[model samples]
Target chain A: MIELQNVAMSYGGGDLFSEISLKLAPGSFHFLTGPSGAGKTTLLKLCYAELMPSAGHVSFMGRDVRTMGRDDIAALRGRIGVVHQDCQFLDHLSVAENVALPLTVARRPLDARELMELLGWVGLKAQADALPPQLSGGERQRAALARAVIMSPDVLLADEPTGNLDWDMSLRLLTLLVELNRMGKTVLIATHDLNLIRAAKQQVSARVLRIANRRLQLAGADL
Target chain B: MRAVLALIRADGRGVDRVVPPTGHTAWLTVLSAAAMAFLAVFALALALATGRLADRWSDALARSATIRISAPVDQMPTQTRAVLEVLATTPGIADYRALDEDEMRALLDPWFGPDLPVETLPLPQLIALTETAEGVDGEGLRLRLAAEAPGAVLDDHTRWRRPLVSAAERLRFLGLISLVLIGGATAGMITLAAQAALAANGQVIRVLRLVGARDSYIARAFVRRFTLRGLSGAALGTVLGMIAVALLPEADAAGGFLTGLGFEGAGWLWPMMIPPMAAAVAFAATRAAALRMLRGIR
Candidate 1:
């Protein structure tokens, strides 16, 4: 439900990317591939209204992101879950508490049973009470995924969701994204991992979009 | 107003999960609030005390004047009688009487003691004049006294009394100004403390924001916390200040201005307002700092 047309991003008096166009439709999965510093993260930021485009328009759902107020942006964000590469968590909070944060911020009631089930789905049920700093990299990635989907968002955006994980961990995390898409959630992931992309294709059909020379293009069966 | 009500209702619900209570800044906020409120109690006491003093001085001096007959010993009685006759015809004067020897001696007791030989000295005769609520015209009274008794001088006490009243009024103004400064300082300190908390918990705030939390939600967590701390600390300070005021030496005729600096009667209720006022200041300061910091994010 996020659309960007002719979007350009600039920083330090120069263009980081320009004339990029993409649309994330319902229940469709897409992978964004780019090398280091090619503005993959910045593109993800634009989709979530974290960064406004230097040119062109970005719309969240049906409304323009530029015209939305602060409260309206917050409400829109609740419908779109995001997973950062760093897997940011309130370290003072336990793993289970961190997973339930989206509902907490939205002022919704916490369902202990649902939280446990989500933790179980992410293979983090055993580490529910552990702190973020205490969790391993793969565990943190899974926990972040659990947090992202806890709200049952209509769209999920993950930036390098498996960047710090091993192949097995990465594939496990990829399967989680596939399961979410199968459940009718639109998913867009930004990464440069070709092997993960090939692994993902074997289980689910996902369009691959590559960012090269400051432009977004649909890559054909390259991996 | 509805937004304020929502913030209030949303205060402690799930705030601890997002912005946990930071210890050092919490202690700083409480201590600063307590100290500022303690100082404010004295400021309030000074204001109330000076207010009462001004009213008392104005009322006691407003409706009265004195006429001093300074004739020679042989002609003093004659001039005194003439002055009395002039006062008798004065329209606004409700009553007039010459002070007897014992009354004059008692008036000078504190300064001259009880051993002064009044009959040996060429002392002046003092006549006390009481006026109606409207009061007598000083110029009219002076002209009448000059015609009837050449040596009589009408002293309305305005020269000395005006300065005293003005000084008390200025003191009251100073006390009020001090209260304002104290409130401003309290707000400044709480704002700094809130900023420090925001900076220290930058990651926490970013995580909360990423999870679809509104700016008001994040701000309410801090605002509610600091407001409660200010209330508790100021409440303690107010009680201690009231106890300290109550223990001051009681006012007496001899104690003069210093003894009257403490609260009297209904004035005791004034210091009780400091706690809630401190809480309000904390609420405003923390909310402003929180919102400003949140705008800088994302």
Candidate 2:
């Protein structure tokens, strides 16, 4: 679980957000909706300890992010999976290799059958040997999702995971995320897609939080 | 010691495959290490050769003196006898002998042609003297020679030997300094190459970090690759350097200094250490660069 109390972030004398308090409990699903420049990605970065708040404290599993060493942060990251908007993959590596990178970095043995099964579940079994540059947008997103869950992290943070996919692909990726949450993994997604939110709300109870006017406000009976 | 073992064992967990392959920096590291190692071999050879030359000059000239008797042709025999008597009475004089006509001819054979008439030309009579472990007092010997043989002069070879030995020692020092500079330059070049590789692979680093890779895991990949490259390149350079030194013309009496510039006896084993040394330098330089670069990210 991640907790931020009275947090504020700034860049070069310009304020991105201020006095924000949020808590992500265990096995809860949440959606963060904001405009393009409303600091949605910045908040996600803070949750993952990629960036520190200019003021106030952010803690992950009871440990303050500001006091953690580089190694400690790395260890914490292993317990939290993040899927970036760009689907950041090593362009030279094959799809299967990219999907299994989390396990590789953790120095764990890679079971070929499990990896193949995971790839088949993501509909990338045929393209396992293909490089990232050769994959379509939907394929890259699904590969990123598969990579994020390969470690079975307790929390998952995704940033615009379906920004480049079509309706069916977005719904498919959303179903995978929903399935992961149903398996007791906490998920927080940052997006501006209302239709996707409506579609997601039909299947699960997801609390919607929107960032407006440099403040985070819970929506009141709104889409 | 642990760092060395880590470098050797490496992360057999396929950690090195995370970073994409870089072409330019690989070639740069290998070629720089090879070139520096080649120069280091020659510097090593020069240092050893100069050391030997210094020792040889010091040992050969320290315990010997020469008496040159320049007198009128008629007084030569009397002066030679007087000098011999004085040397026989000296406490530190181990042995003394006046050179014969054939020995004198052999001494001057290199400067003058073999056909020169040595017995007829009124050259000075030369007497070679060997001293005991405690050498003779030059001033006392000169005073005695002047009283008994006025034309006799004692030369203990100090003036000639000191300058030659000093010059050889200085040359040896310079050779050692050259080796140090070469190693420093090699480290600088390898550091630059490692930094460039790290900079070019920023995306690889970011992706690895996001997936929970520690700094040590990331650094090991680069360190192993660069260290191996340095080892292979230096090995090639050292072998080629040894071959080039062995193929030089053999040292001969006519070719005095330059011909003797090479390893001798057990000295051949010295150049074999260059490859491993280069590998160590590469390992240190690349590890430092990788860690420093990783600190700046995230």
Candidate 3:
């Protein structure tokens, strides 16, 4: 339920992409692929209103994201779960508290049992009391994902969710996204791992959008 | 512990999760607050003392005037009697008393140490006059005194009273200025503390920003922290200062004037407000710093 129509993005006063467009439908799974410096992260930033388009509109649900107020944008973000590549966490807080941050910032109370179950979904239940610095990269990523989806957001956007993990951990993380997709959440993941995409295809009939020549294309047939 | 509880419950407006990176200045907070409170104690005393001085000066001056009759030793008693008769018929002069030998000796007791032989000495005849608030015509009374008792002179006590009143008023003003400076200094230190905290918490701020936390939410944390510290420190200082002020001597007749340079009854409550006022200053200063830093970030 996120759409980018003729969107152009610039970062630090340099154009990264222009006039590119894609729509993310409900319950759809899409893999965003691109070479290094191809603006994949920039595209996801546009989808979530973290970065506004320099020349065109990025729409979230039915409203134009470019024109929305900050409060409106924050409210919209509560419905879109984002797992950053860096997996930003308050190091002073425990993993469970970190995972529950989105809800806390939204002024919602935490459901302890439900949060533990979500933490367990990505296999991080035992590490709930551990701080971000105390966790491994894979564990941090899983915790980030659990944090992202804590509010039961309609859309899940992950940037390099499996980047720092081994093959087994990558598959385990993918299964969590796949499970979310199966449960009616739209998922768009930015990754360079083709093997992971191939693996994902075996489990879910997902589409692939490849960024090249500063444009987004359906790369499923080529794959 | 009490401060922590107030912060956690924070009136439901929400605690801002932002604090300065460099951390808190617990000692500085306490020190500045204590210092200001101590000085404020003096200021409160000065203001109260000035108020008392103003009342005493006005009271002693308002209804009183003096008459001094000087003449050759042979004519002294006759001139004094004539001056007294003239004063009794004066319109606004409500009452008059002629100071006798023993009364005049008592007046000179402080300076001459009760050693002067007053009865054998040739001293000026002193008449203390009480006037109605409406006041009689001093010029007409002086002319009458000159005609009836040529040596008699009327003194309104104006010349010396102005200087005394002015000196006390100046001390009161200086005390007030000290209080204002103390408050301003407290605010400045708190501002610097807030800025330092902002710099130290840069990473925490970056993380919060990336997570889409608003500037208001982050600033609230710092504002709450600094404000509580300021209030606590100021309160401690105020209590200590008040204790010190209470130990000061009272202004009885035996105490003279220096002992009167402190708070009277009911003037004790004025210094109690400094702590909260200091807290408000801290809250405003930190909130502004946090918001400015937040805006500078993406």
Candidate 4:
């Protein structure tokens, strides 16, 4: 679980936003919605310990993230997969290699059959050998999602994962996230698409947090 | 990102793999190391040879003093006998010898040729003297000879011999310094090469980091690649260099000229160390360069 208590992040004091408080309880699902440069990615980065809170404390897995050693942070990050909106990948690697990277970095032996099954879930088995550069935006998004969940992580954080995908592709990715939540993994997604959030509500009971007035608030029943 | 995961999970405890994948070839590094190592062999040989030359020059010149009695041609034998008698009673003289007819002729063979009749020529009588640990004062011996045998002149061979030994020693030192410079240059080049390779693989590094790969693991991939290249290349250079040295014509005893260029006896083992030393240099240089490059990103 990730907890941010009285957290304030800023660029030159009043440039963007600051003074936020939130807690991502275990096994819960939430969506973070904000306008461009509203600190959505910055918040996600803070949760993952990639960025410090600037002021106030951010705790990951019960340890203050700022005090954690680099190696400790890396180990903690291994258990929580992240999907970037850009679908970052080593283009020289095949789709399968890219998807299996988390397990690889963790140095865990991978079962090829299980990996193939996961690839099948995302409908990317046929493109397993294809490089990231050759994949379409939809395929890339799905591939990115598959990569994020490959670790069977206790928590998942995706920053606009479906930003580049079409509506159908977006739904496909959303369905995957819902399935993961049903399997009991906490998921926090940062996205600005209200329709996607409205659609997600129909599939799973999830909370939504919005960044406004330099603080986070529950955007209940707000499209 | 997936690659980082795979790397981390491939080995338990998140240990960074120091060895690169087999297909990550580095022929250029191997070639460079080999070429440099080969050149080092010659430089090493030069150092050793000059070292030996210095020792020989010192030993051959040490403790040797010559007595030249320039009496009238007819009185030369008498003056030589008198000088030898006086040298026998001298306190500091450890050993003394009067050269035989053939021995004296042989000494002048280089200048006078084989057929010169040494017993017939009225050359001044030469007496060889070796002094004790505390060498005899040449001037004191000269004054004694001047009083008893006024025509006797002592040549200690000090002036030319000291300069010769010093020059040889300086040459040996120069060779050693060249080897050090060569090693330094090799390390410098490999560092630059590693930096270039890392820069070229920036995207790869970014992807690996995204997948949770630690900085050490990413740097390992590069360090291992360059280390192997440097080792192999240096080996080739060393072997080829030794062969080239071996092919050189054997040294002749023609007074420290062309023949002084190659290794002598057990000195051959010196050049063999060049490859491993080169590899060590490459290892250190690449490791340093990779770590610096990694930290720059952080």
Which one wins on TM-score?
2
Candidate with more favorable, higher DockQ: 2 or 4:
2
B254-274, model 2: which lDDT tens digit per residue? 477877888999999999889
Off by over 4 Å in 3: A212-220, B1-24, B118-122, B209-215, B253-258
| Model 2 interface CAPRI class | high
TM-score, structure 4 vs. true: 0.88
lDDT of 1 by residue, A37-153 (tens): 999999999988888999999998778999998888888889989999999999888999999998988889998999999999999999999999999999999999999999999
Candidate 3 has an lDDT of 0.83
Best by DockQ: 2
- The ten-residue window of minimal lDDT in model 1 chain B covers B1-10
Assess each model's interface with DockQ, reporting 2 decimals per model: 0.76, 0.82, 0.33, 0.39
Candidate 3 C-alpha lDDT tens digits along A91-170? 77789888887776667777899999988888899999998999999999999999889889999999999999999999
Ranking according to DockQ, highest score first: 2, 1, 4, 3
Which lDDT tens digits does candidate 4 get at residues B1-298?
2332343234322232322233333665676677778778888888888888889878766878898877788787778778988898788889998887888888999898999988788787788888888778778788889888878889988889989899988988998999998999899888877877777777676666666777777776776567667877888888888888888776775554446788877888878778667767877888788778766542
Candidate 4 residue-wise lDDT, A1-223, digit = tens: 8898888887875635566888888889999998888899999888877777778898987789878876677777787889888888877678998898888776789999999999999999999999889999989988988998888888899999888878998898899999999999999999999889999999999999999767788996765
Q: What TM value does model 2 have?
A: 0.97
lDDT of each: 0.89, 0.91, 0.83, 0.81
Q: For residues B38-134, could you state the per-residue lDDT of candidate 1 as single tens digits?
A: 8899898899889888888877888788999999889999999999999998889998999998888888888999998777877899999988998
- Report the lDDT tens digits of candidate 2 across residue range A25-98: 99999999999999999999999888899998999988899999998888888899999999999988899999
Q: What shift in Å separates residue A141 of candidate 2 from its native position after superposition?
A: 0.7
In the range B217-288, model 3's lDDT, one tens digit per residue, is 677777777787788888888888888877777677566776787666677778877887788778777777
C-alpha DockQ for predicted model 3: 0.33
